[model samples]
Target: MKKVTVTALSVVIGVGLLAGCTTKNESSDPAAAGNASNGTKPKVVTITVRENTWGARKDNFIEAQKRLNEDLKAKNVQVNIDWWPGIDDDELVLQATAGKVADVFMNSSVDIGWERDGGLIRDIDWVKDSSVFKGVPDSYTNIMKYDGHYYGVIQDMDASPVFISRKALTGLGWTGEQIDGLKDRVDKGDFIFSDLVNLADDAKKKKLVKMGFAVEDKRFEGWNYAFGFYNYDADQNKMVLSPKVKDVYAFWSDSVKRGVISEGIGDIDTDKAAPMFVKGEIFAEFARTEFYQMMREANGMKDDIEGYNKWFKDNVVWIPVPSAEKGGKPASYSNPAMIFVGSKVDDEKMPYVQQLIEHVMDPDLQINHTIASGKLPVTPAAQEDARFKAMDFYKDHAYLVSFTRTRPAHPDYATFVQGFTLGVDAILTKGKSSEEAYELFKKEVKQNVPADHVIIQ
Candidate 1:
């Protein structure tokens, strides 16, 4: 692993300064050295960084940027962050292709594959030798690789579990013990996917909630959770579309028919759905662990965990999505946020960008960020950090890491997700049957993904 020592960093900074000064002839560039020797500040190399607000705690990024600037101050360089924050994926791609992107950016783990394939991001092959990343788990690092080349560094790990509102469940006359038992049953696969629909239907019929069940309005999320009932062949890197997908679609269609799910759910967005969940309008939805803070604030707990617990108790349940059948495996996804370097960064500025990444990847910073932001740590060392271990939230949900499975990091993964989303939209809005939707999905995948990259089951 490449170790970035104080001496080595100093030399690298010195070389950058010297390189900045040299123009035509070294001796003739007296003004450059004179400015440095006479205490005039050298030119500042401002490295812009753009990060998405989705699943991010903005304050953590701001704090990391401040720390990076503080470390670079001694080297007479500065990092100016041009924070363009939003969850618009298409906007990011447009900026990257137009060479208007920041030097470094944050993106979803799934984007690493196609972005690298499209030449929008640079391959950090040298990261394999970096001591700074040695403590990070391979599970996190491997997701950032495409065709054996590392393209990004994981920023954080989070589990997306199906969150059931405790208040709504209690309103439905569910006892505390019954709510606890529900989670246990789900974990044991005794409570299956069909059972979830039945419960939601019952809740709706009893007027316990306006909407008995809800998934994220996002197309990819909807498809991902629906298809998660099936198995992914990790050995073959193929997605096996389970025969149960037909049943899954039928379950949702029936839910819609019974008024268990929202009528205009196809048009619902996360912003609209989040508030509904907070207001007790929805009984259940799929959300990441990072979203707990939003719920806390909505309930007026405002960083008061104890207060939130007292108000809600065990009313809210966090469990893996139930299996399609009894005794079958339940599913959960670990979607890690990652940082990538833009392909547009010049060779001369690359070292500074690397230095900034090193500063951000510091063990202390990682631990602090995890504690402050409620995002999981990427490295085992950070997870074991004394400060991180002290958080009550981390202690309670840490076991989720063991069961989480990440989607395959294939170069054509983005195409598959898009096709899957389109198929799901057709089923929900166009009155298509599961068989018809799946056939259309297969056709779209075949057309969009390269033959060499396609993995059929």
Candidate 2:
């Protein structure tokens, strides 16, 4: 049997594509197996990656990919992402399961479940040198583990999610007093989905703001935060994953019907939504921390940018969806995107992979990228990275790591995800009640799907 050890009881997130997962043992060519035959190390290796959320078309990610490619080329290795554009998470899951393409897939959550069915392109579970992970904290590994083996490495290590809303609040004539009132209501647990439903409709009719909430519609943030509605059933020891997941669907559907939540959001992709929010029509949104910088860049030529800054002078607030009910901290789940090595590559290159991991692992690298991307650092040490140190959002949102989560740790998590989505559709589009959605969710899970365990690595 391969040697394995529980280094410590690391914190885990109970949400998204990366809940609890497992990976096959890592084999080092000429090292773990004691082969060491090649006098010269393998100079070329191809790595698979997911394009950044904005995709490589964005200058920042494109530049990083360029740098990585150049770095690898200098050493005789070539790294390329099995670039999949215009693809969503569900599609990625299907692709991974079919083993159709991608030797390494990073930036996917559903891939965790596929690992149970022998879907992984490579397994780095047996990585032994602690030095490779030195200075890197336990939190960053959330996306890399499958049953305690490191399978994926992160390309960009941002962990913070930011607040997004529009400058419309400024035009609404609501001074700071009105803003504080809303937050006070939110804090008092007086705000409920029903209430938000009303707010959305009222906003549309009264023009309080455009779209009371910027529905992310994307599975990662907007869709997932909806789960926080009923996510706090701690007796069950896990956040609920059924469609009945905390009235998320019903709330949105009703809000949509009432003209509060935009039906267009259902079709809105990140490409469209980000710009929509930045246009200052959205009341509030869930964003990565870089939103302000994006705003600053937008302001480069006009005083309206100053107006935009004033509107959010203290207003762009970050709020996690309430847990299980309307108040208290909700059981939030989080999963940062990740980088996975390719199975097609031989073990001889594992050392090189480790080197890359180390290079990105530097405190400076982690902090700079975190700031560049407006994300939280995964490492506890990186938490204090100058980026966070300098930002009030960081100091104020101290609860982010302390309270949020990742997907569950299980091989059959994909089925749960599928079922969860079904529940969401039923709730939002089908007018299903919470009870009804939960029943449909449970039925989907109980049906003949993959068991909740992955036997293959």
Candidate 3:
């Protein structure tokens, strides 16, 4: 859910090294060689976009603008984005809501999801007639829909969240069985907290794994999403937090007892967790393909990444988190970023918004996007990109992105997740019982989730 800059992070990791290292866009440099080569600034449109928090600079904005400028130039339009990532996301959201911020902001669909309920955001569906929006899908349109209205544009769609073995599944004792065969024994297609205990015991006997499993029980994701539990049933209007809540905590604790998983699993975010896998301690973990690095960077593990790929060329299997019931489909969730347009702006600005969103949907852009960011693409054809075809991570495990359920679209979503995580962490760390933590969290959520709103079953 971080509205991060792939470009800045790219620079952080030294990706896509821009051709020349020119200091600036002076007439003397070739990196800026294309600056004066284009047509007159098509009205020099100034569009404000939030800056990325990852050390991204105004010049980085200039660079993205430079590329976007080129794209705009091709279509004979002039434009600019005001990059503005800050240290505080909530404060920025407040600023934007108060009309003191940028024109466009990158946030989980919750922004427009809130907007869709009323004047929260403008309905931009009227712009579909614009040439910029030729082939985008209705699925993309559905993301912006709320209460029968479409108000935002969805930029990217990743797979529902998934848990992965740091190594392969066979390492967890799935040997001699096909993926489908392995799928049957796990109740309801769900792998419960207890199943992992037995598996870990088996692995220990075989010296196959260091721990049973890893659980970020309090992760914004893992908290509300532990399988075997029923979340808010909007239609039913009942709260059943404990269905899988106890096991969520139990899974972490038992994993801790088994000693197969990392003790500090849930303490840190992906940045820290990834390294544990790199250290070759944990057998598997949950993450998107973008994190294959942690495993690739194992100490003294050479560029065997190229070699690993050649070997698993078509064997990297992706699977969902096991559910509590055997034969039950495991569910994973992914937060989506919604693209919104300012309703207060004149009708003329509508086309511009369409152009921006449409540009996002551009086939070439999506191809490069999937290549640059390990996030899954919503466009089916985009998956055929040579870059995607070359990636080993997606070879067999590709469908991990196919089964995702969209995250809730409420303004309080983030805070609710934060509260849930803290409560769960207390259950895992402070020895607070799950019932105690869940009770505290339920009260907090009831106070916040609105009286009329429903919590899923």
Candidate 4:
């Protein structure tokens, strides 16, 4: 057996994943197991994975690991998944540089392309033809690739839905039935994007909420898709700075000018947005499904689905971000958690790594994990699971999957996001005009991203 050298961590947008197991009973121990019925010793290997979410908390991944070991034992081999402590993104990059990343780890989808380019992760391009990928959505898988090769296996996908406050709407003279049917209206294209702002403005005017809509000032990746702006054209192999981007900037600036949104919104972080919702300062805000779960935890209902559901019964509802007009297209942003293997794994250990991938991608395991962790599933089977469908935020998020878009997994994606965000920040925080912001956007992208890779129309 080859020595294991890589030690790593898994980080997902402030949310957690799988846990570790510590029991060393011989029945489950790879080293203790041998052919008791015969006289032969079976080959055994241990795989290391980083523990995710809520430091030191036990999670469903332990159950999945147990199942994998049982299955491997049948093949005359035994496996043990040893879990390591988690680390932040900067540390991950540093560790990757030192070739000390864990044998298995996971990170945000947008980071994989660069990780692949830096040769920090292995390219499992064969997943394109593997049965293990069956039922996983392309929106989840596509963002795990870089330069047309798969470097990560999707753990889960999340869509940003516009969360509306029932209490605020009721304050604006909306009837109970109307509030109940709003999601269906948005689904059927009866409620357009403009309708969202219009209603928010009305709510503010009525003194029902201090602000009508809310968003993070410095991070605009999710909102870019929410407004139907795609910054890159993969087929053309160029970044697109269309007129639509300026339109989006103009819309936000106009909203701030109209006093329906907070001027300080541009200064807040994503974690701060939810509290504005809870405090009734905002009538609606674009948020990922995990935001709802965080709310549940905050309200002292963590892990108690019944209490969580009751707490949100009439408190809030998620709706698709409005279409441009009736029957127009709907949009949302999706980001998936991607599991990766360190590139330094030796040939003898590669097959076990492959087995670990297959185990992680299993639809049932994936579905159960998401249900426990308050995330959406990546596969059709997992999406349809009764447990997952039972979550309060499931219907709207699942319905919007057809319209969700993912960030391009370009090697320079982090740089592109920074450039795109700075442009938006200039308008929202720096008080720059839309024209000024547009110019800044063009300059930033052109100066940082390869010229041939960007097209500023």
Q: Note the Cα lDDT for every prediction shown.
A: 0.64, 0.49, 0.50, 0.69
Taking the tens digit of each residue's C-alpha lDDT, what string does model 3 give over 1-457? 4221111132322222222211223212222223444534345555655444321223233444455656655555566554444324434334434444445555667555444433325666564464543444554554556545666666566543334342445765465445444434432565653565565566655666554445433333533354545344423333334435655656555554555555355664566555554444444455555454333443333356576554332333345555655555665555565556654545776556555556555555655555445555555566667776777565344555445555555545555655566666665566666676666667676776555553533
lDDT of 1 at 412: 55
TM-score, candidate 3, is 0.70
Model 3 segments beyond 4 Å from truth? 1-44, 52-77, 80-87, 113-121, 126-142, 160-194, 204-208, 220-263, 297-305, 308-317, 430-434, 447-449, 454-457
TM-score ranking, high to low: 4, 1, 3, 2
Instruction: Report the lDDT tens digits of candidate 1 across residue range 265-308.
Output: 75555556666777777777766666666677767777787787
What ranges in model 2 sit over 4 Å off?
A: 1-105, 125-139, 157-202, 220-246, 253-257, 287-315, 324-327, 344-348, 391-399, 407-419, 426-430, 446-448, 451-457
TM-score of each: 0.74, 0.62, 0.70, 0.86
In model 1, the Cα lDDT at residue 133 comes to: 72
Runs of candidate 4 with Cα error greater than 4 angstroms are 1-31, 54-61, 216-218, 346-348
What TM-score quantifies how close candidate 1 is to the native fold?
A: 0.74
Candidate 1 global lDDT: 0.64
Most lDDT-accurate candidate: 4
Give the candidate number with the greatest TM-score.
4
Tell me the TM-score of model 4: 0.86
> Residue 197 in candidate 3 has what lDDT?
56
